[model samples]
Structure formats: C-alpha cells, structure tokens
Target: MPQRPEELVELLPAANRFLGREAEVGDPTERRGLVLVHDLAGDFDAAHAGALAGAHLLAALPHEVIARFDADSLVDYRAHRPRMTFSGDRYESFTAPEILLYALEDDAGSPFLLLHGTEPDYAWERFVAAVARLVQQLGVTSVVALQAIPMPVPHTRPVTVTAHATRRQLIEPYPVYWGEMRIPGSVSALLELRMGEAGVDALGVAAHVPHYLAQATYPAASLTLVEHLERLTGLHLPTEALREAAEAHRTEVDEQIARSTENVAVVAALEQQYDAFTAAREGTDLLSGGEVPSAEEIGAEFERFLADQDRKKPRD
Candidate 1:
C-alpha cells in the first residue's frame, strides 16, 4: 500500500516531457500553458455528466496514459467492489478499478492533461496533494474540474451552469447565485478550494441537470459541460456525437412526458418559472423571482428519489 503522495502515483516515461526532464527533473522558466482537467466518478455527479464528457474527450482526441494512481490503496473494495467473471464453479477474470492521468493533444496540437476515474474512498487529502504536486512538477498553468448537479430546471430550456473559480476574474462572465449554503462535500470541490489557497488558478463548472431526471442519463448536460470547457480553455473538442445523443434523448423524454398529465403540469410550471426568471433577470435565484418552487425546495422534495438509486446501484 502506498502511503506517500509521491508513491501513490507512477509517472510513466511518457510524462517525462511534461516534467521538464531531458536527463533529470528540473524546473523550467518557460510556461508550458498546460491545463489539467479532472472528473472523478462518484454519486456527487448528477446524471454522470462529467464522466460522459471525459469519455467523449478520450474517444475524440489522441491521448496516452502518463500516470497511474495506486487504486488499491485509495479505493474501498467493500464500498465499490471490482468486477469479476464467473463460469459455474470457476472464476474467469477480474477487472480492476483505475485512476489514470492522460497527456492529450487538442485538435490544434496544443497539449493538456486529464485525470479521470473512480473517486477515491480514502486518503482524499493525500490524493489531492499528489495531484497538486503533479500540477507544479508538470508545469500545468490551470486546473479545471467538471461537475454536474441536480436543480429544479426544465428540459425544455437550454441547460444552465454554475461557474466558479479561485479568483473572480477567472469566472467573470458567470453570475453569482446564493451567498452561502451548506451541502455535501465532494473531492472535486475540495481540490478547487485547496488549489485556490495554494495560489494556483483552479475553476469548475457545475451543469444543472433537471432534478427529476437526475437518476437517468442526460446527454444534454454532458454536451453543455463540454461546450463550457471549450469556452473556458479554448480547446477545440468534438461535440457532434453528444449533440446527436442529446437531441434523440429530448424527443424520447418529450414523448414520455406527454403521456402523463401530472408530469406535463410539473414541466409547464417549471418552464413558466424559468421564463419569468430569464425575463426579469434578477440577481436573486429563480425561487425569489416569484411564487414557484426553488431549486433547493424541488431538490429536497426529490431527495428520496435519488437515495435509492445509490443504494440499488450494483458494486463497481
């Protein structure tokens, strides 16, 4: 079991170029303009939007694994069991969990880093430290965290996002929603906070997934996330496939909602709320715009809905 941050990850030969190492690791005065994007897989991600966006990037671009984290030390097997194949009385094969860092080239041949895989079940602080070390050693200029969150939003409208950053200027175009509220913590959020404290530029985008469809796959949210990433980082990523999936998903969702009068009423009410907030364009949240359920209220009402989705989920 690796106990130290340096030991937790193995940097492959492919990573040497980023380390400013020709014969040995040394600091370079020149900026490499490297960006690191991390999307740790966990229940915190509503509708698995972050994971899908990361997957899409890997599929569309050229990349290579640069580092491999010690998953055995970080993961709790009982919490997320590994997959194994069985045939009668014989065990055939087992698939292990992975936390990998990849070095990828954008469409314009610009280089960046991507850290993706299951969220750690242990040693979160150490894991974060290890990544921080990598960011400094590999000359990463910025770190971006991709996330998805449930909100009282309607699928009929364009997807919305909550953008955040360590510094105000990094997310100047984004609106400031609420003052402060306590919520469940996730590793990605913590990383952003810590990175900010370290004087390193870190930012994140939380795509709003409709609270009602939080349990189901929503490609629109994923597409929106990727689009925002492109906007923020100037990365030319392919979104055609995700766009098609979202379009097809919208039609299916509409057909299903049309069958249920209750569901239709719910959507209409949400749409009205959405439109009112957009028209008035208040600094306050949608809930304060008028007498409609707030995102927090709707989320609380549907809390029970997502609870079982995790309990019923099969071991990884």
Candidate 2:
C-alpha cells in the first residue's frame, strides 16, 4: 500500500477547516452508501459533466459533506526520473497531481467516496487496490462507480447504461447487461474485484455516448449516469440544467448533420451498426471473445470511417 501523506493523516483534525463547521442539513444513518467515480483519461469536459451530475445527486439527497481531496494536490513520483543519453546525461522530470477523493455523508449516514484522477503512470490495479483499502478502513457499505463509454451511437438518442456488480444479490432489481469473467483495463473493473475481495459491495455503471460528440459534447452521458445513480441510490438529481445542455448539444449536431451530406450518410450507417450491435448483445446470454472489440480496433475503425467521409467530401 502507498503511504498516506501527513496532510491526509490529519483528516478528522482538519475536517473543520476543510468541510466547514456548520450543522449538517440532513442525516440518514439507516442506509449508508458510497459512490466512486473516475475520469480515467482526464477528459476535462466529461469530468466536469460527471462532477455536475454528482453534485446534483448530492444536493437532492440528505447527505453531509465529509472530506474532499483534489487530484491536483496528489503528486505523481513515477513521472519524475533522471535520464541518461549517449550524448549527455540529463534529468527529465515532471510532477502532477494524481488522484482526487471526495467523502460524502449518505442518506443512510454512510460515507460515500468519489475519486477522479488524470491518467496514471502505474497500472490501474495498484490504484484500485489502494482505494479498496481506503474504503475498507472507512467501513463503506456499498460502492457505486460511474464512467462514460464513447460509442458510435448518435447523441440524439437516449444515453444507454451498462452495469456490473460485485454481488448479484446486491443488484437484484436492476438489469444485468454485461459481465467480464476476466477483468479489463478499466479502473472500475479492478476496483470491483478488489471490493468483492474485501467484502464491500460495489457496482459500476458505464454510460454510452456518441463517440463523435464526446470531445465536443459530454453532458448527455453525464446526465444519463446521474439518472441511473438516482435510481440505484434512491437520490433525486435536478436534471434541468443537464437536460438543457444535452438539448443544445443535440441542436448543434443536427445543424452539422444538415450542412454535410457525407456526414449525414455516415451517421445513417453508424445508426444501423449501433442498432445491430445492441440487438446482438441483447439476444446473447453470454459474451464470447468475438463479441468484444479491442480498444485499439475501435479507435482504428473510428479513424477509418472519418477518413472515408473526408475523402467523399467536395474539395475546397
């Protein structure tokens, strides 16, 4: 386990200065829960959206603010290294904050922790293990993890959510869309495994958003995940703001699609592929190796599709 900085060691003592000493609005100790979120690649817009959605959920429910840790304050030592070259030896080092943590008092009076970070130099396994240990120490009852998945689907459609739980019994009411017998590179996957090993209940929800719009628009996926969080945690989130943002994103995409005939055609094709993929997954009880596409393959396909569209466009 990584050693905690002296600053984190004095959390309870620093609580008054950090979280304010005002009386909490609401306290619910019966059904305590915790939520963990991460923007794995540091997609700034996506992270902002996720943060907004999280804030909305927190505001709607009777929960107390516990502790918040900014990722910018957590230093990364792995990025700092001395380099040696044949021509000359030089020291090349860079330092940046690694992870952020937010502790919330849930309606059930349980502590919910939210985590986000920039892409780390080390493997996700190490990070997840450390977080699991922290959760164990905090005695968090249930953990909910959220993420956004960039997909070929159109932004005009409703965002779809896929969920995985450490224990099937914990998520009995919700639909079980997918599971990985072998874990993947996503931090959520590793953390789910660690949570199970530590006897902490954990669930993950991945919101699917149109890949084309992910860079320029992200609030749609954020709102979608927020809705799911409300359902899972029994918390109400004010979606008016997010809904407006999503509608604006839709209008922008509509204008772009109308202006370009090639883009319109490409979108039509993507819609078909999206529908087919969803149907295939829905019809299958189990996932096979052939059903999943590697991240590199997906990226390549997106590039090829965009290139072909560019080639078909009228030259200036």
The candidate that achieves the highest TM-score relative to the unseen native structure: 1
Task: Output the worst ten-in-a-row residue range by lDDT, candidate 1.
Answer: 284-293
Candidate 2 lDDT, 195-285, residue by residue in tens: 7887777876766656666544477777877777767767434677778877887787789888999988888876676566667767542
Kindly report which residue stretches of model 2 are placed more than 4 angstroms away from their true locations once superposed. 1-52, 55-98, 104-112, 117-119, 123-126, 173-184, 273-316
Error of 1 at 92 (Å): 1.7
Model 2, position 44, has a per-residue lDDT of 23
Best by lDDT: 1
In candidate 1, residue 206 scores what lDDT?
80
TM per candidate comes to 0.90, 0.63
Candidate 2 backbone collisions, by pair: 28-108, 28-109, 29-108, 31-108, 34-112, 71-99
Candidate 1 has an lDDT of 0.84
